[model samples]
Structures are given as structure tokens and as C-alpha cells.
Target: MTRPLLDVRDLRVTFHIRREGDLPWTQPRELHAVGGVDFSLAPGETLGVVGESGCGKSTLARALIGLVPAEGQAEWIDGKDLIGLSPRQMMKYRNDIQMVFQDPLASLNPRMTVGQIIAEPLTTHHPGLKRAEVKERVKAMMEKVGLLPNQINRYPHEFSGGQCQRIGIARALIVEPKLIICDEPVSALDVSIQAQVINLLIRLQRELGLALIFIAHDLSVVKHISDRVMVLYLGRVMEIASSDDLYAAPQHPYTQALLSAVPVPDPAHDMAASVVPLAGDLPSPLAPPSGCVFRTRCPRATERCAAEVPVLSGAGHQTACHFPGPLTEAEIAFARRTEAA
Candidate 1:
């Protein structure tokens, strides 16, 4: 197999949770924000990460870009481990990987002009670039992201949500990063604007050959842009498969439930179609369930699910379930019947 541009292996992130009135000041409580996760992204490919809220998708993205402290291996480009990099080395590595945060209004600096915001990365990374050159580069980037060059002088507040996100994308792309970790980029925008932003991402990716890890809760939104999809639950990956295979025939029970919830467009056909809501709320990450993180909500879960954790195994498609497979015809018929009544 060809070497991928980005390789993440057993990536885990933990945070210290302190109560208002805890016992000893020296003692600290640990919360596992991200459980072990493994995935890869080829050069110019997009891997969509989908899950419910607080499922650690954003935390994983932050860890990949080194914005947050993480344990486990995140090897980028030529097998360089991000976890071991020093502050100075990490500073230099920042130019190669960037992130587009969820909230555009909060991600941008209110005080900085659009030009300065975009040029800041270049000026810091490539100090040799003169003032005129920096300005020219920023203008070019603004244009690349569909923003007018004149708007370079404006602040983020002057633009709409979509326009502000464009500025954010310009800032990330201006550095010419090899990989971009997009954390729910369009969830904040209206449904109409979401399509526009998604389309813009697809166009830019094809043109620039940018490797992407798009994190989103909406499975259908990511389906349009991603090559492969990874379904996560309670900080653990439930399934990983090609977009064609996963959506057409989901394996894991959790994945099945998620896909079942997406409303089909046509009402006349598949008139019995309806969403299947998962049984219960996602368990707390601080103290995740004993074995399978999704067992509490998975319909097919058994005693084995509560005892031994299932390891991901498959050739092209992997699912972390002992009895993972596509739903049978009878099962589909039953689900439709249940939804109707």
C-alpha cells in the first residue's frame, strides 16, 4: 500500500477535571476525552469523521493539529511524531498542518484586519517575504477562497457567517499546509449556506490537492465530499468504510442506527421510511461503559459486548463489533414496520 500523507495510530487524549471542592490540591482527576483511534488520509483525500455531540470528534481534530495535548502517535508527512516534538519544532510544524475551527466568529481575531489575519502565518513562517510580497500573497489567498481582494482591509464582523468562514479558510490555506483538520466547519451556518460551503470545499480540494479530515455530526453533509467515512461513539471508533459501502450497507449496530435516522428525500417511494432513534443518551466519557462504548445504546449488544471490547477487523472495511454485518432483509422490514407505527 502507498504511504499516506497523515497517519494517526492509537490516538488518545485525556484532560484533568477538577471539582470546585475536591480533596487534595496535588491530586488530579483524569477524563479520557479521546479513546484509542486509528485512521489514515492519503494525499488529497478527505476522511469524514461523523458522530453525535461530545463524541470527541472535535477533540481528535484539535489533537491532530497540536492545539491540545494528546497521548499516542500522530505521524505527519515523513514519519515525524507530533507528540515528541519540542516547542520550537512544533512551532515550525504548525506551517505544515492547520485547522478550521467550528465557530468562525470566535476563531478570527476581532482586532486584526483580514489582510493581517491571512498574512500573519506567512510573515511568521517566511520572514524573508517583504511587506509588498506579504500583501500580494494575502490578496491571492483571499481571492482563492472566493473573497474579493478589496475585502482584505475589512474585519471579520463586516462579513456574513459564510464570508467569515471564507476568511478563516483563507488564513488556513495561505500557509499552504499539507493537511487541514476541519471541525464542523458549516454546522453554524444556515442549511442553504451549508451546501455552498461544502461545495466550495470540494472545488478547492480538487484544485489544490488538500488532504482533509472533516468532522461533522450530519452524515449526509459529509457524504458529498468524503472518500471514506469513520463513525465514532463515546470517543471510540465504531466503524470505518468507504462511503459507497458504509452508507449502502452499514455493519456496526451503532452505524446502522445512525444511517437509519437520515430522512430519505422521496416521500412517495419508501413511504414507510422513518428515522430510528438510538435507545439512550451517550454515556459519560469520564467513565465510559465497561467494554463496548456503544453497548448501552446498541440493539444487537450482548453479554460479550459488556465483557470484552471488540477490535476493528476487516480488509477494506472495518467494524469494531463481534457480530458485525449488514442488516438482513427481515431486519430491514422489521425496522420499517417499527418506524411506521
Candidate 2:
């Protein structure tokens, strides 16, 4: 087996938030944003992380690249433990790991020219690079990500939403990072634009031999780009498997419900689907239920589910649930038909 380029184990992120109607002396409440997430990525592999909003998908990504404080090991194959590094200490690994945010224009500095924005990482990480060298590399990267070399002098305001995203891609790739964390990179674009960006990332990953942690709520998009799929709920892993196995035979109730909700391409097929989509609001992370976080909303949930937290098990496929099995065909059909209220 090729050693994983990135191996994350029992990663957790927590935040202390002030109460809504705050009293100055009140102690902050603990918000368990990422309860415990574990996964690994080999060189050139893509791991798609899917979950509903506030399920800790974004928080997990942020924790991996050192954007937020994380507990547990994020061991890069080179032996660096990202969780222990300080801001200044982490600087050395910036080129090895990069991130592309969701909003294109919002991520860029409108005051800076495209060249300046893209070259910022290079300048910061490679301070010895001459101005001329930075410009040359930035222009080359622009060409790679479908941007124009001559447009380097243009500010972000001059570009469209899709173009601004291309600029973000160019910026992330400029340093030739080993891994790229794409946090809903396509969510802000048009469907057509989303396709273009997805394809661009696919090709770029192949060309650069880069690993990717693609985090998004869109199951179809995740299926398209990922070799493996991980399902998360309430800051914890629900199930994980190869994309084929995941879509065809999802074990966890949450994964099945999520896949059932993905729009079928054929109207006839959608009409034929009987699986009920999940219902009920995602429970607050601040005061999660005693055992499995998903029990409150799970149809098969029982007293055992409320008494014990299930552990993930398996070699090629893993699921964390008291039942530890896939939904029956009948249940899948019900899940397909039941839409969220």
C-alpha cells in the first residue's frame, strides 16, 4: 500500500460561544463543532466529505490545514503533526497544503490585482523569489487554471463569478501544494460554472498529482469527483466506503437518506424512487444527544442507539451505527420518497 500523504486520526474541533442574550459574567457554552473525524488520503487521491449544513464539514477542513485549533493528530507522511504547530511554525507547511474557499470574489482582495493575489503565497512562502520570477510563475499558473496572462493586472471586480473562482484555483495551485482542501468550491457558482470548475479541478489534480479533500453537501458532485466518500452527521463520521459501494449500498441511515435526496437525472427514475429523504432539523451541536448524535432523527433508532455510541468497523467499508447495516430495499424506497419538511 502507498503510504497516505495525509493521515488524520480522531481529529476534534470545539468552540466556546457566548450566549445569545449574554451576561458579561456568563461562562461561554461549549460547541462541539467536530466531534471526532478520522480519514486518510494517498497522493493523487480524492476524498469527498458530504453532510448537511453545520455538520462540521467545513470545520473539519479548517482543522486539517491549521486554520483553527485542532486536537488529535493530522500526520503528514513527512512526519509533521499539524495539530501541534503554531502560526509561525505552520508557515513552512503552507506550500504543502492549500485551501480554496467557497465564495470566489469574497476570498480575493478587490484592492489587489489578480497577479498580486495569486503571487501572494509565492512571495510569502518563497521570499527569496525575485519580482520577475513571481510574475512569470503567476502568469504560468493563470494559464494552467484557464485565466489570461494579460489579465494579471486586473482587479477581482473586473472578473465574473466563475472567473474569480478560476483565479482562486490559480492562486491555490501557484505553490504546487501536495494537497488542496476545496471547501464547497462550486457551491457559489452557476450549475454550468460548477461543472467547469469541477472538471478543472479533476484535470489539475491529475496533472499535478495532488491529493484533494473535497467537502460539499452536494452528493452528486461528490460522487463524480471522489474515489472514496465519507458521510458525516453532527460532527461525526457515519459511514465511509468507495464511491461505488456508497451510492449502491449505503449502510448508515444518514448516508442512505442523503443519497436518496440527490436529484435523479431521469424524471422517470426519480418518480420510481421510493426512498424517503431525511426529516427533522439537525440537532444543535451545543447540546447534542447523549449517545449517537443522529438518533433523534433516525427512523430505526432504538433504546440501544441512545445508550451506546457505535464504532466504525470494516476494511474496505465502514459504518458507525448500532444496527451496523444498510437500509433494506423497502426502507431505501421510503427514504427516496420522504422529502424534508
Candidate 3:
């Protein structure tokens, strides 16, 4: 096997929030945005992160790139821990890790021309390079990401949403980062545009040999572009497995429900019959369930699930569920008929 490019363990990101009208002395509530997520990425591999809106998919990505204050180890293959790095300290590794944010237009500065935006990273990292060299590289990157060299002088507002995203891709790639964390890169695009961006990313990964952490709510897109898919609930991983394995035989109840919600393209397929209904809203992270964060909504959850936390175990396909395996037929039926408590 090729050596892993990045290995992360026990990664956690917590935020302290003080509500309105609270006394100065009142203790702030701790919101665990990411609770011990662990994963590894090989060179040129894509790991898709899928979950509900509040799950820590974005947090995990931010934690990896030092955008958020995180705890635990995110060891780069070069023998550096990414967590807790100061801004100056992180500058050294900025070229090795880059992020493409969800809002393409917002991520790009409207005041700056496309050339300047794409060339910004190069200027930051390779400050000694002459302006001419930076412009040539920027134009080359723009062409690579499907933008015309002549349009480099145009501002972000001049382009359509999809074109703006291509510009964002160019900026991220301009630095030639080894790993690119795409936080819902395609979610904001039109459905047709989403496919274009996704294909662009896949091609870029292939040509550039880049590893990607693709976080999105669209499972079908994730399945298409990812070698492995990880399912998160609240702030913890529910299942992590190969795209084919996890989608084919989802072991965790939460994973099963999530997969079931993916719309089947076939017109004749009974979408309603295939769905595994989940109960209740996601529990607030401030006071998550003690044992299993997913237990409150999982039909298969039992007494043991509520008392003891399940460790993510298994060789090839890891799942953090006390009863890890495919949901039985009866359980699916029960979940479908059950209403929120």
C-alpha cells in the first residue's frame, strides 16, 4: 500500500458559548463540534464526509487545515502535528494543505481581479518570485481549471456561480497543495453545475495526484467522487468504510437512514418503501447523549446503547455502534412506523 499522506486521531473541536442574559460568572456551555474523529488519507485518494447540516463535517475540515482551534493529533506525513499551530507556524505548511470553501463567490474577494486572487497564494508562499512569474503561473492555473487567460483581469462579480467556483478551484490549486479540503464545494451550485465542479475536481485530483477531503450532504455525489465515505452524527463518526461497502451494506442505523434518503434516479423505484425513517431532531451538542449520540433517534438503539459508548471498531469497515451490522427487516419496519418521542 502507498504510505498515508495524512493520519488523524482523536481530533476534537469544542466551542464555549455564553447565552444572552447570563451572568458574567456563569459557566459557558461547551459545544463539542467535533468529538474524536479519526481517519487517514492516501495520496490521490478522496474521502467523502456526509452528515446532517449541524454535524461536524466542516469543523473536521477546518480543524485539519488549522482554521479552527482544535485538540488532538493530526500528524502530517512530514512529522508535524497540524493542531494548535500559530499563524506564522502554519504558514510553512499552507502550501501543503489548502481549503475550498462552500460559498465560491464569498470565498473570493470581489474587489480583486481573478488573476490577483489566484496568484495570492503564490505571492504569499513564494514572495521572492518576480511578478511576471506569478502572472504566468496564475494564467496557467486558470486555464487548467477551465478559465480563459484573458478573463484573469475580471473581478469575481463578473462571473457566474459555476465560473466563480472554478476560480476558487484555481486559487486552491495555485498553491499546489498536497491535500485539499473541500467543504461542501458543490452544495451551493446548481445541480447541473454541481456535476461540472465535481467532475472538475475528480479530473484535477487525477492529473495533479491530490488527496481530497470532500464534505457534502449529497451522498450520490460523494459516492461518485470518493474512494471512502465517512458518516458523522452530532460530532462523532457513525461509520467509515469504502464507498461501495458502506453504501452497499450500511452497518450503523444512522448510516442506513442516511443512505436510504438518497433519491433513486429510477422512476419506478419505490423511494418511500426504501427509506429508513429516523425519529426526532438531532440532539443539541451542548448536552449530547451520554453513551451514543445517535441513540435518541435510532430505532435499533437499546439499553446498552444508552449506557456504554461504542468504540469505532472493525478491520476494513469501522462503525461506532453497539449493534454494528446491517439493520434487520423488522427493525426497518419498526423505524418507518415509529414517530418521534
Candidate 4:
């Protein structure tokens, strides 16, 4: 068994935000963004985090890299805790971890040339590198990510969306980071272009032995790339399992609902398919629903769900539910009665 490159436990993130009508002296309320999330990543492994918006997907990713202030253990491979590091302290790990943001154009600097954008990390992290060394390394990386070396002088706006993303990938890889947190990196590209970027990440991970935390709402894309998938709902994990297990037989009701929603290609199948549509809105994180955060929307939720929080408990296929397995329609109806009660 391989040791994890990064191990996270009971991770939580909160933001102090002021409401619109609040007075100046009124206390800022805590928006509970991430709540007691836990997972680990072996070196070179990809962990895909999927959930609807405001499920704390982005918050969890940023917390791992120390971009956002977080609490709880984010134990690195070397046993260093990544939880409470000051900005100065976290800088040491910046070279070892990097991020590729969701927006390709917005993430890159329009003012800086592509070469400078790629070289900036190397120059900042490894200050003693000679100008020629940085330039040569940038050129090598540019070629590696399928961008022509000559295009190094071009600004970000000069390139297409896909090309811009390639530039972003080059920038993240130039530092030779061990783990890269990709926050919906290809979401903005065309469907065909998304495939290209995904394949590029796959190839690079294999080549460099890099670990990845790929965050996106696209379950199909996540299934294609991830070794393990974690299902989050309003800051808490509903389930975690191998991509094969998750897609083949989802254990949690929330997970099953999500899987049911993925579009099937065949028109005949699409016509006959049944979606397990969840009934309620995503509960507010500012004041999350008590007990199981997902209970309100889960089709199989019951009295136990409201009274007691279900911890993730399983060997390989984990789920936070009292009845964690395949669900029947009758059971779903029973849950609805509980909701009405």
C-alpha cells in the first residue's frame, strides 16, 4: 500500500460575511463553506470532487493549497500539518503545490507575456536561477504543453481559449509541483477542447508522477479522470468511492440522484431514463440544516437522519447514511413521509 501524498481530516472553512441590511457595528455572520470534509491522495493519484454549486468544492481545493484560511489537518506526505500556516509559512510549499483556476483568460495576466507568466513562478520560487535558465525552461515547457516556443512573447488575449489554458497548465507545471489543484480548469472551453485539455492533464500526470485534485461539476469528466470520487453536499461529504463503484452502484441517495442526472448519449435510452430528482433547494451554508446536511434533499432520509449525523463508515466504498446501499422506490416514498412529518 502506498502512503498518501496528502491526507486531509475533518477539514472546515468558514467566512465572516456582512449581510446587506446589517448595521456597521452588527457582527458579521459565519458562512460555513466547508464542513468536516476528509480525504487523502496518494502520489500521482487524481481525486475528483463533484457537487452542485455552493457545495464548497472550490473552498476545499483552495484550503488544501493554503490559498484560503482553513482548520483541521491537511497532513502532507512529510507529516507537516497544512492547517494553520501563515502566508509566509505556506510559501515554502507553494513550489510543491500549484493551482489551475477555472477561468482560462481571467486566471492569466493580460499585461504579462506568456513567457513571463510561465517564468514568474520559477523566478519567484527559485530566485537564483539565471535569466537564460528561466527563459530556456519556459521555452521547453511551452513546447511540452503543445504551444510553440515562438508564441512566448504573445499576451494571453492573443491566444484562443484552449491555447490560453495550455499556457495556464504550462505555468503550473513549470514549477514542477507535486500536486496541482485544478478548479474547473476546462469548464469554459468547447466540448472538444475540454477533451484535449483533460487528455493533456492525464498525459502530464503520468509523465511527471504528479498528483491532482480535479474539482468540477461535470461528473462524466470526473469519472473519466479520477481514481476516486468524493460527493459533497452543502459542505459535507455524502459519499466517497472508486469511480467504478460510484458509477456502477452509488450507495448514498444523494449520490444516486446525482448519477441519475448525467445525460446519456443514446436518444432511445434518454427517452426511457428516469431521473431521481431531489425535492428541495440546497440549504444555506450560513446556517446549515441540522444533523445530516443532505437529509432535506435525500429521497431515503428518515427520523434517524434528522436526529443523528451519520459518519462516513465503510472499508472501500464509504457513505454517510443509515441505510447505505441500493435503495427501492418504496423506501424513497417512506422517506418523503418522514419529510412531511
Candidate 5:
């Protein structure tokens, strides 16, 4: 087996929430944002994480990069645990791990010029370089991401949504990091523009040999770029498998329901007509439903599913489902017969 370049084990993150009319001395309840998630990524591979909003997809990305406080083991490059590192210790790890946040406008500093923003990492990590070298490096990064070198002097608000995201990418890539945590990088852009940014990311990944943890709510977007895809619900992992296998024959009920909702391109077979609608709002992370978090929304859920949380098992494909089965030939035939009738 190819050894994973980055490995996350039982990663968990929680936030404290105060109860109503509670005294300041009272201990706040812990809201589990990420609960015992595990996955690994090899070099030059993209691991896509997909789920609905509030599913902790974004939180998992932030946790890996140490942007948010978290607990659990994160081993990268040299078997070092990132979660246990101090701020000073984490500073050394910064150049190896970078993040491109969801909103470029919000992520980028308004006062700083694009060149300044992109060069900030170098200044912090490689301050020995001369000012001239920094300017050259910043301009080169802009050009690499299909931006005009002349615009290196421009501010964040001066660029278009797509351009801003490109600048964000340039900044993330300027450090030449080993892995990038992209949290919905293009979800805020126009559909046409999303393709451009995704293409840019793919091209850069190929050229630079970078590993990526791409987090998004849209499975179609993830399907376009991911090598492996993992489905998340609430704060827990539901399934993890190769992109092709997961899409072709999803092992989990949640994964099937999500794929069923994807709009089919062929107008003759409208997916909306055949797709199953997911019911109920996603339960609050503060008080997630007992056992399987998805039991309330799953169609194949049973009493056992509600009584115990299924562990992720299997050799190649992993799923947290008590009753795991593919759509058998018999089931497919029956469905086709019903459609014919």
C-alpha cells in the first residue's frame, strides 16, 4: 500500500456553548463540531468531503490546518501530531499546510495589496530574502494563476469574484505547500466561473504535485476533481471510498440519497422525478440525534440503526451502515419492471 502523505486519526473538535440564564461560573456544554473523523491522502491526490450545510465539512478542513482549536491526532510528513503543537510549533508547520477559505473577499485583507498579501507568507517564513526577490516572486505567482502581473499591486475589492479566488489560490500556492485545505473555494462564484477556478486548481496540482482536501456541499463539484470521496453527516463520517466506486455503487443510504438528488444531464431521464427527497432538518450539532445521526433522515433506517452507531468497516470501502447492500440485480429488475408498468 502507498503510504499516506497526511493521516488524520479520530480527529475531534468541540465548541463551548452557554445555557440560558447560566451563571458565568457554570461549565458550558460542548458542541461537537467534528467527532472522530478519519481519512488519509496520498501525494497529488484530492480527497473530497461532501455533505449538506452544517455537516461540519468546513470545520474538518479548518481543523486540519489548525485554523480552529481541535483535539485528535494529525500526522503529516514526519509523524508529528499537529493538534498537540504550540502556536510557535505550528508556525514551523505553516509552510507545509495552507488553506483557501470559502469567501475570498472575507479571507483577504482589504488594506493590503495583492502582492503584499501573497508575499506575506514569504516574509514570515523566509525573511532572509531581499525586497526585490519578494516582488519578483509575487509577480510570478500572479502570472501562474492566470492573473496579470500588473495587478499584483491591486487590492482585493479591485478584482472580480473569480479573480479574487485566483488571488486566493496564488497566495495559498505561493508558499508551495504540500497540502491545501480548500473549503468551498468556488461555491460563492458563478457556475461558469467555478469551472475556471477548478481547472486552475487541477492544473496547478498536476504541475506542483500537491495533495488537497477539497470540502464542498456540492457532490457534482467534488465529483469533478476528487480521487476519493468521503460522505459526512452531522460531525461523523458515513462512508469513504474511491470516487468511481462511491458514485457507481454507494454503500451507505445517505450517499445514495445524495447522489440521487444530483440532476441528470439527459432531459429524457429527469432525476428530480425519480430521486428520493431527504426529510427533516439536519439535527443540531449541540445535541445530535442518538446513534446514527442520519437515522432521522434515512429511508432504510431501522430500530438497530437508531440503537447503535455503526463503525466504519471493510477493506477497500468503508461505510457506517448496519445493513449495507448494493442495489442488487433483482432489485434493479424490479424497479425497471415497475417503471415499465
Candidate 6:
């Protein structure tokens, strides 16, 4: 087995918020953004994180990079625990881990030219390099990510959504990080552009042997770029399995519903037949249900689900649910009817 580059165990991120209430001083509520996510990534491997919005996908990414305060262990193979590191302390690992944000243009500074933006990381991490060296490396990275050297002087607004994303990719790669966290990097672009950026990342990953944590709500996109897929819901991991296994046979109710919602490409395919209907909206993380966080909306949820929290367990493919497997025909029918009513 290739040694894992990053091993994350029981990682959690919580936030305290105070909302207006009848009392003079309302007690702050704890919002569990990430309740305990565990996974590992080997060099050159890609881990796809899929869930609905607000399911802690971005939070988990931010936690790993130390953008948010996180608890539990995120041990880098090189003997450093990533959790609870100060910004100054994290500077040591900045070159090893990088992030590509969701909005490309927004993530880049409009005032800076493309060259300046891409070269910023190099300057920060390798300040001793000569000016000529920085410019040469920046131009090389620009070409690597499908950008023309002539466009280096152009501002972000001068480029298209996809091109801006290319610039972000160039910026992240210039540092030559071992792992890159892509938080929905292609979500804001057109379908064609999404494909282009995703393909670019795939090619870059292959060529550079970089590990990636691709977070996206698009299951089809995730399936295309990921070796393993992890399903999260209400700050908890619902299921984790190899990309082929998870899509072919998802065991958790939440995972089933998420995959069922993915649009089928075949026009003749029966969409309704494949869907595992889920009733009710996602519960508030501030007051997540007592046992299982997903029970409030899960069709297979029972007294056992509400009475006991399911620990993520299993050998290769893991699921955190009292009853894990494909939804039964009866259960599917009942869920569909319940949604209709």
C-alpha cells in the first residue's frame, strides 16, 4: 500500500452563534459544522466530497487548511498535526497544502495583473528567488494550466470565468503543493468550462503526482475526477467508498437520495424509477436531532435511528446508519407517497 500523505481522524469544527430571543441575554448556540469526518489520501489520489449545500463540505476543507479552528487529529505523514495550528505556525506547511476556492474571479485580486497574482505565492514562499526566476516560473505555470504567456499582464476582469479559474489553478500550482483542496472550483462556470477546468486538474494531477480533495455538489463531476467518494450530511459522514462502489451500490439513505437526484443523461431513462424520495428539509445544525442527525429526513429511519447514534463503521466501504444498504421497494414507495402527501 502506498503510504497515505494525509490521515484525518475524527475531525470536527464548531461555531457559536447568538441569535435574538425573548431573554435579555440569549445563550449562544453551538453550530456543529463538521461533526467528525475521517478519511485518508495517498499521494496522487483524489478524494471527492459530495453533499448538499451547508453539509460541511467547505467547512471540512477550510478546517484542513487551518482557515477555521478545528479539533481532532489531521496528521500529515511528515509528523505534523494540522489541527489547532496558528497562522504563523501554519506558514511552515503552506507550501505543502493549498486551496482553490469556489468563485474564481472573487478569489483573485482584481487590482493585480495575472502575473502578479500567480507570482504572489512564489514571492511569499521563496522570497530569495531572483525576479527573473519568479517571472520565468510564473510564465511556465501559466502555460501548464492552459494560459497564454501574453495574457499574464491582463487583469482578472479581462478573462472569462474559466480563464480566471485557470489563473487560480496556476497560482495554487506555482507553489508546487503536495495536496490541493478544491472547494467547488468549477461550480460557477458553464458546463463546458466546468469540463475544461476539471480536465485540466486531472491532467495536472497525473503529471505532477498531486493529491486532491475535490469538493462539489455535482455527483457526476465528482465521479469523473475522484478515485474515492465520501458522502456527508448534517455535519456527519453518511458513507465512504471507492468511486465505483459508492455509485454502483450506495448503502446509506442520504447517499441514495443524493445519487438519485443526479440527472440522468439518457433522455429515455425513467428518472422517477431511480429516485429514492427524501421527505422534509435538512435539520438545523444548531439543534440537530438527538441520535442520528439525518433521521429527521431519512425514509429508513426508525426508533433505533432516533435512539442510537450510528458510528461510521465497516471494512472498505463504510456507512453510519442503523440500517445500511439500498432502500427497499416498500420503503421507497412509502417515501414517494409521503412526499406527494
lDDT of 5 by residue, 1-341 (tens): 77788888999999899979999999999899999998888988999999988889988988887878999888886878889788899988899998998997898999999999999988899989999999999999999999999987889999999999998999899889999999999999999999999999999999999999999988899999999999999889999999999999998877876887888888799664566566667888988888888888766667998899889887778998898876444544444454355
lDDT of 6 by residue, 1-341 (tens): 87689999999999988776636577677999999899988888999999999999999999999989999999997878989888888898988999999999999999999999999999999999999999999999999999999888899999999999999999999999999999999999999999999999999999999999999999999999999999999889999999999999999988988899999999999998888778888888988998999888888778988899999999889999889988888989988998888
Scored by Cα lDDT, where does model 5 land?
0.88
The regions of model 2 sitting more than 4 angstroms off are 20-25, 270-273, 329-341
lDDT string, candidate 2, 1-341, tens digits: 98899988999998999968999899999999999888888889999999999999999999988888889898898878889798898998888899999999999998999999999999989999999999999999999999889999999999999999999999999999999999999999999999999999999999999999999989999999999999999999999899999999988888877776777777678534544556567889999998888988777788999999888888889989889666777765444445332
Top-TM-score candidate index: 3
For model 1, the local distance difference test gives: 0.86
**Number of the top-ranking candidate, with lDDT as the measure:** 6
- Candidate 1 deviant stretches above 4 angstroms: 25-27, 269-273, 328-341
Give per-model TM-scores: 0.94, 0.95, 0.98, 0.95, 0.94, 0.97
Model 3 alpha-carbon drift over 4 Å, by segment: none
Ranking by lDDT: 6, 3, 4, 2, 5, 1
Regions of candidate 4 where Cα sits further than 4 Å from its true position: 331-341
Would you list the clashing residue pairs of candidate 1? none
The 0-to-1 C-alpha lDDT of every candidate, in the order given, reads 0.86, 0.89, 0.92, 0.90, 0.88, 0.93
lDDT of 1 at 253: 77
Error of 4 at 66 (Å): 1.5
Instruction: Judge candidate 1 at residue 155 and give its lDDT.
Output: 87
Candidate 4 pairs with clashing backbones: none
- lDDT head-to-head 1 vs 5, winner: 5
Q: Which sections of candidate 5 miss by over 4 Å? A: 327-341
lDDT (10s digit) by residue, model 1, range 1-341: 77888888999999998888887755677788899999888999899999999999999988887778998997877888887577798987799888887898898999999999988889889999999989999998888889999888888899999988988888888989888889999999999988888898888888889999999998899898899999998889999999998999888978887887777787675633445455556898878999898877665668999999999889889999988986666656655555455
